[model samples]
Target chain A: MILTVTLNTALDITYRVRSLRPHTSHRVSEVTERPGGKGVNVARVLAALGHEVTVTGFTGGATGRVVQERLASVPGVVDALVPITCATRRTIAVVDDRSGDTTQLNEPGPTVTPAEWSAFQEAYEALLPTASAVALCGSLPPGVPVGAYAGLVRTARSAGIPVLLDTSGEPLRRGVAARPDLIKPNTDELAELTGSHDPVRATQDARRRGAGAVVASLGREGLLAATRDGRWRATPPAPVHGNPTGAGDSAVAGLLSGLIEHLPWPDRLTRATALSAATVAAPVAGEFDQGAYEELLGQVVVSGEASAA
Target chain B: MILTVTLNTALDITYRVRSLRPHTSHRVSEVTERPGGKGVNVARVLAALGHEVTVTGFTGGATGRVVQERLASVPGVVDALVPITCATRRTIAVVDDRSGDTTQLNEPGPTVTPAEWSAFQEAYEALLPTASAVALCGSLPPGVPVGAYAGLVRTARSAGIPVLLDTSGEPLRRGVAARPDLIKPNTDELAELTGSHDPVRATQDARRRGAGAVVASLGREGLLAATRDGRWRATPPAPVHGNPTGAGDSAVAGLLSGLIEHLPWPDRLTRATALSAATVAAPVAGEFDQGAYEELLGQVVVSGEASAA
Candidate 1:
């Protein structure tokens, strides 16, 4: 079973209004909610791909209950979320019907108490033993130590479980230094971490910083990976134009799933690139188009050289 | 007990962001939730004024649960909300810290099924016998008949309970014809109802259309009323300005409480005017400043003539 950790889980809500205007009241014509966080999104995609996945995170209060209830309905995904006292945060995406633009309002996640953090670490360790691969994803909620992912990555390494760290800023920098099996950082995140805009240099610099492998998601351009086995650039056959939300999580899901399946580096890149493109093309956010994924999987172009070492 | 009916109850959420720009992501720094709807707001103010208040409405789903839970925490307020299958709506007031302006996003209330509507009417009828006065407030949720408030007004009257109707549009129009004991319309609602921007003419016109009495809330100018006892204009000693969000509801609470207390028309007007001004002076959106209310109560100027009869 693949394990995904979302320390700062969210109940994502989308509201559709005829048009958005500042300081005026709007009547939202539609509302949609989904259990979300980077890891949760990755878990959902993994489950959809027929992988047995367990999701662990801090969930509490009414919003958390809604998230858990919705997560329960998704097949092949198990909820192992740690209970906390504060209500989980909510992220609202207000979509304007007129221009198809979205204004986002995000509430800060519940602050994790020290005891809750300790309890989460214990729960995560308990799940690690049976997990084939683990993905540590998203931002750290307040009150959790700054080096949270770094410590988690070290634990997974000690347990001999492959882990993929997908986060940004301090967490990612610290997690990378813990030498996770893989890290998938989008272009902005990669640039932030390595202080370089050059994709190849940043990806390689991330690996040298202790990531076993680095896959940088360059939206539309696709994935660039530097790994122990090889370096590869994978791109979708044609540019897919749609909502890019959750595309990165799909890439992470693809990479983790391919790793568990023991796919070669180039094949993993192909799957990751195709899945990311498919997610962008999906009518609904956080879901991949199965037909697009299958077709693009065969069409993704992969070019790279095997590592000389 | 004073009974307040919010057919379209809501979980009112306030998000404080540094700034709110359209189509841009905002990180809300603070969040506050309150049980809201015009009736709910009235009930809270009545409860704060030491009146035993019973709140009944259709509540369902997670957001409804949150509303109910918060209502339960209010000291003198009783939650008698009827259950439904659909979730209650949420109204988000995004407060921009930089500019102190608020953008409101209101979700359309749950579509009340016929069965649920019937159930609510039954619950409302049961509560009416014990209620000294009933207040029908806010818009009718979808699926409720347009004449819902009219039917409810007639029911309360039949039970010998005076009903105060506080709503706008067709609901208010239909409810007025049912001869509710009192109808409070703001300047805009009055204009819409009577086709007259002149508050005195509109208020009198509203009364002739069937309201036992008409009270027009004229923002900073104060309250103008045409009642069986007299015609009066009540104004605060001076303009009280702050957040006027719930000032109208506070006025409704004051009028209802004074009516049940058997206060004279002039005294009722004074109380209503003071409470409205105090609500505006309060730091919080829906609460009235007790000190301000007490201070303003004595200072409110009421000038009127007793009806010739």
Candidate 2:
């Protein structure tokens, strides 16, 4: 079973309005809510791929209760969440139907107290022993140390579990030093991490900084990888156009699932690329188009020096 | 004691964003939640005035729990809310700090099941015996008959309790037929009810349609009342400016309080007008500035043939 950690989870809500005018009132035509965060999305995608995944995160207050209730509905995913005093944050995405534009409002996640942080650490240690691989994802909530992921990475490594760290900014910088097995940074996050516009150079720089492997999502350009065993560039069969919100999480699920299956680097890249594209084609984030996935799996081109050999 | 009915109560949420742009994202700087609805606001103001107010309506789910918890904090107010199977709705007010503009997104309230509607009716009947007056406020949720308020009004009248109806559209048209002791309609609602934009003419017409008294809120022009006792026009000393969202609810509370106090029509009009102005000056809806209320109360002028006395 793969374990995914979301330190800052959210009750993701979407409101549909005819149009969003700055100072006007709207009778929202529709409302929707779902459990959200990078790791939650990854766990959901992994579950869809028939992987048994356990999700651990901090949840509190009324919003947290709703998130837990939603998580209960998803099959093959286990909730191992820690309780906190503060309510889980909510992320509102107001969709303007006329303009097809989305206006997002993200609340800062609950502040983690010292006791709560300690509790989470204890919980993480308990969950690590049974995990084949662990993915530490999303932002560190308030009161959590910047190097919190580093400690978790070290624990996972000690347990002989392959760890994947996906985050941005200072947390990524500090977590990299702990040497996670894999790091998935999108184009912007890659630029922020390495300070280089060139993807190939940035991937190599990230690997040198302590990441055992670097898989960089180039948005529509597809996936670039630099690993000790092999390096590969995987491209989608066609340019997929849709909401790209959770594409990266789906890619992480693909890579993790492939890793557990012992697939070759080229085959893993193909699966990851197809999954990313299929997620974009699906109506909502964290859900993939099974038909699209099946069609694109054999079509994705994984061409690199290692794959050629 | 005043009983305020909010059949479609809401958890009012406000999100403060720096600026709201179409298709963009915002990190909300702040989030505030309060129990809200037309009747809930009325009850809060009545409670502030030292009146024992019992609030009844549908509340369900986690949001409803928060609403009840918040209602507990308001002194002299009782929560007699009915429970439904579905969750209560949320109304979001996104305030753009840069432009000082507010964008509203209201979710449709819970769908009331047949059993839930019967339960609410039973609770409403049980509370009417203790209420000096009843105010049926806000819109009816889905599955509720358009004549729901009309039935409630008849019940209050049979119990010898003065009932105030403050709703709009078809509900208003149907509710007025029950001969409620009072009906408060804003400019647009009055126009929709009587098909006349002229406040004086519309108020008289609304009274003719079976409303015992018709009080029309004419925005900054103040209030126009055509009652069985006499006709009166009450205005604040000067036009007040601020958020006018809950000014009408405050007016309803004032009128109900005056009715129980056995104040004459002119005095009631003066009190209601002053309260409305005070509410506009308050930072939030349903709350009034005590100083402003005192000053405006003495200054509000009531003029009509009856005021000449």
Candidate 3:
């Protein structure tokens, strides 16, 4: 089973309105909610692909209870979230029916106390031994140390488990230094970390900063990987467009599952690229279009240079 | 004890952002939550005014639990909300910190099953006997009968209780015909019910439609009352500048309290006018500034002509 960590989990809520106007009242036509965070999303995709996954994070308050209840209904996923005092935060995506644009409003996550953080660390360590691989994901809630992910990465590595880190800002900067097996950052996060707009350069630069490998997700374009085996660029057959909300997380799931199965770098990239495209075509986030994934799987074009070293 | 019925209760959540821009992501700077709906707001104000108020409505799911928990913390308000199979609705008010403007997003109320509606009716009827006055408020949730409030008003009247109807649209249309002792309509509601924008004319017209008396709440201009004893206009000392989210509910609270106290029409209008102004001066909904209420109470001027008949 794979272990996923989301330190700052959220109850993602989507509301659809005819139009979004400032300082005006809107009647939300539809409302949908699910457990969300980078890790939770990855876990869902992995579970959908027949992988057994355990999710660990902070779950508290009424929102947290609802998140746990929803998670229980999903097959092949286990809940290991530690309890906290404060309620989990909610991220609202207000979708305008007219323009098909989404306005996002995110509440700051619950502040994890020092004791609660310690409890989570213990719980995470306890789960690492049985885990084939681990994914450290999302932001650090207030009160958790900024370098918290770095320590978690080290713990997973010390247990001889391959770990993937997916986050941004100072946490990513610090976590990379702890030498996680892999780090996935989208274009914006990649640019912020490596100060390079060019994807290839940023991916390579990120690897040089102690990440075992770097995969940069470029929206619509696809994935760029820089690893010990080689450098590769994988693109889908054609641009699949819809809601691209959880596409990156799908990519992360693809890469993690491939690593555990010992797929080659190119094959992994192909899977990741296809899964992302399928997720983009899905109506809801944290889900992939199975038919689209199957069709795109054989069509993903992977091109790169073999390592000279 | 005063009984208030809100067929469509809500968990009102307010998010404060630096500024509101459509199709963009915002980090909410502050968040606050409370039990809400027109009657809940009225009950809160009445309770604050030292009245023991009983609130009966439909409550279900996690949001409903949160609403009930919050209600239990309030001093003089009792929750008699009936359990339902579906969740209560949520109303989001996104307040822009910069411009002090609010953007509202309201989720439609949960559909009450026929059994749930019957349960609520039984609960409301059971509570009406001990009530000094009853206030029926807010929109009807889906699945509830359109003439639900009318039935409730008739039942209360049969019990010899003075009932105030404070809703609009077809519910108000049906409820007024039941001959509620009083109906409070704002300018828009009055216009919609009477097809006349003139407040005095519309108020008189509403009375002819079977409302025993009519009070039109005019924002900033205060309250205009057309009652059996006389016709009067009640004006606050000055315009209070603040959020007017629950001003109408506060006014309803004041009128119900005054009616039970057997105040004259002019005095009832004065109390309602002062409470409405005080609610506008409050920082949060369902609350009034006690200092403002006290100061404005004595300062509210009521002038009118006596009934010649």
Candidate 4:
């Protein structure tokens, strides 16, 4: 079983309009709602691939109830949420029909008190020992200590569970120091973290910072895997265009599922790359076209290189 | 006592950003939430002015609970919501800091069942006998009978309560034949309803259809009130710039407050115009600048003209 932690979850609301007029009234053509958070999205994709997944996070108020209910309703994912005092955050995506672009308005997520963190840690510790791997994903909410993900990674390591850290900025910087088994950062985020735009160089920088392996997701380009076995790149069969809201999460799901399936490094990279491509091409957030992914997986070509030493 | 009906209420959410960039992420500078609907906004302003207000409408689910909680928290307002299975709608306002303009995205309200409408009608009938007037406001949700407001206004008239209808689309078209004592239509809505851009001619056309009085809210230009007592044109001292959401609703509150206060036609027109101006000048929705309104009320010049008929 894979344990995924989404510290800050949201009720994602997407509105479709002909065009986004900055200061005008618009009649939206449609509205779509979903449970959103990096880890949740990862778990959704994993469950779709028939992986056993447990999602844990902080939730509160009516929006929290909505997130929990929606998460539970998804076929194969298990929800384990810690109750808090504040409502879950809401993320609005305004899609402009004419330009096919999206404008995201995200609310800073709810604050989690020290006591709530302690409760969450306890729940996580109990689950980690029974899980194959733990993925710490998403942003840190207010009131949470900046090094919260590091603490979670340490606990999972203590339980002999391999931890995969997927986050950005401060949390990512701090968590990387704790020596997680894997760290998945996209091209820009990789460049931001390592100051190197070259995928090989950035992956090397990430691994040197204590990540045992690094999977770099390059938007439209493909996936780069830097593991102990070797370095490999897998590209999708064709380039696809759509909203890339959950592309990174889908890659994380692919990487984690690959590990659970005991696939070789090359096959794992292929799977991650194909799934990420499918996610980028998906019409909605946190959902992927399985058939597209499967077809893409068969076409992925992985050329190997010596591991960074 | 004044009665306000928001058949499809909302939890109005506003997000303030420096600019709206499509398909890009934005960090909201500020956020505000208020209980809203056309009638709800009217009730809020009236309550601030120290009027006895009872809101009678269909409300259910968590969103409805939030609305009820907010209304209960505000002083000088009473809630008498009839229960329904559907949750109330939510309205999103995205404001651009540079342009000082708002982009409003309104959700389709809950589908009200026939049983729900019947229950709501019973609740309205129970409240009408004790209320002095009724303000029917906002769009009718799906599953609600198209002429829902017409039936409601007839019930209010039977109880000797003057009904004021404020809505648009088919609901307004159907409800007009019920002969509401007052109908507050904006300039464009007035043009759409009467098929004339000229406010003076359009107002007479509105009265000819079924309204006893037509209080046309002409935004910055001001108020045009055609009543049994007399017709008056009231304009503000100056055009105040700010978020104008709910400004018309505030005008409805001012007009209703004046009627209960026994202010003459001219005084009522002036007060309503000032309140509308104050609402437009306020930084937030459902909030009016009392000092500005008081100052502007004194400057409002009410002029009269004999009817062409």
User: Each candidate: how many clashes?
Assistant: 0, 0, 0, 2
Model 4 per-residue lDDT tens digits across residues A155-189: 88888888899998888989999999999998877
Model 2 misplacement above 4 A: A307-309, B307-309
For residue A282, model 4's alpha carbon misses the true position, in angstroms, by: 2.9
TM-score of chain A of 1: 0.99
Candidate 2's residue-wise lDDT over A1-309, tens digit each? 999999999999998889888788888888899999999999999999999999998999999999999999999999999999999999988888887678888998789999999999999999988898999999998999999999999999999999999999999999999999999999899899899989999999999999999999998878999998778899997899888888999999999998888888888889999999999999875589999999999899988866333
Candidate 2: Cα lDDT at A197: 88
Q: Give the number of the best model, judged by lDDT.
A: 1
Q: Write the per-residue lDDT of candidate 2 for residues B148-261, one digit (tens) a residue.
A: 999999999999999999999999999999999999999999999999988888999999999999988987888899987889899899889887878999999999999999
lDDT of candidate 1 over A9-69, digit per residue (tens):
9999999999999999999999999999999999999999999999998999999999999
**Model 4, chain A: how large is the TM-score?**
0.96
Clashing pairs in 2: none
Candidate 1 TM-score, C-alpha based: 0.98
lDDT of 3 by residue, A235-257 (tens): 99888879899899999999999
What is chain B's TM-score across the candidates, in the order shown?
Answer: 0.99, 0.97, 0.98, 0.96
**TM-scores across all candidates?**
0.98, 0.98, 0.98, 0.95
Candidate 4 lDDT tens digits, B58-104: 78777888888888988878999988887788888888889877778
Q: What is the Cα-based TM-score of model 2?
A: 0.98
Reproduced native contacts, each prediction:
0.93, 0.88, 0.89, 0.68
